[model samples]
Target: MGWLHSLFSPLKKLWFRMHSTTQNKGRGIYILYEDVKSCPYEDVHVLWSILVESNSASLPSKK
Candidate 1:
């Protein structure tokens, strides 16, 4: 138990740092449920990008 705690302590700190950085940059992660025909070049990016739905139907309504 002690060894496990020692090993994971550093990992936990690293994960927190990464999560905080992502939040600070105002970037979010998402999973695409289906394939899309096309998307804007400026919106869709490989990493740390803001997800924009080309179709309004695919997006959830804000209450």
Candidate 2:
């Protein structure tokens, strides 16, 4: 499974970085906003994926 782990390693790192960066500081909302504003284009897809995943997971499912 080494290849599988390697395949996901970058995504895992991105998630950890985003999570830790936001959580470690006070005023997370403002910090996240600033980070997004300054974030590089290459990282935007990863950020968007994280947002979509979290948002969908948090919402209640329709019956």
Candidate 3:
């Protein structure tokens, strides 16, 4: 496991930084759901990104 993880240290850092929403802060760890209310506990991003949404708006204007 150590060897495997060593291979992804860069990716790990990027994932944590990007997805955590705030670098070096614990806001990434169940903080919203555990500390706040009025926010949906179900809607959360587990990682930095997911499947790309089709760029429907990027299509060139119709003729």
Candidate 4:
């Protein structure tokens, strides 16, 4: 029911946050590329580009 979802959603999120593994608690990003050997070069390039751009934007510039 909708009411049940509303009641439990926050609790579920809290539970996961409290119980998450060490690997899931960091600021690191994890990308899963299944069948990496067969993945297209363009796909990898695009992902790399987005990550680079986002990281650069988030970093503070030095004067």
User: In terms of TM-score, how similar is model 3 to the real structure?
Assistant: 0.27
* Worst ten in a row by lDDT for model 4: 27-36
Higher-TM-score candidate among 2 and 3?
2
User: How well is each residue in 1-63 modelled by candidate 4, as lDDT tens digits?
Assistant: 999999999999988877786556442444343434346788886787787699899999999
- Give all candidates' CA lDDT scores: 0.58, 0.82, 0.54, 0.71
lDDT for 11 in candidate 2 is 99
Give the Cα error of residue 41 in candidate 3, in Å: 36
Query: How many Å off is the CA of 38 in candidate 4?
Result: 12
TM-score of 4: 0.36
lDDT of 3 by residue, 1-63 (tens): 998988899899988878766643565544553544444443433321121123345567788
C-alpha displacement of 30 in model 1, angstroms? 19
Candidate 1 vs candidate 2: which has greater TM-score? 1
**Candidate 1 lDDT tens digits, 12-32:** 999999989988655422234
Position 28, candidate 4: lDDT: 40
* Highest-scoring model, TM-score: 1
Clashing pairs in 3: none
How does each model score on TM-score? Answer: 0.39, 0.38, 0.27, 0.36
**Using alpha carbons, what is the TM-score of model 1?**
0.39
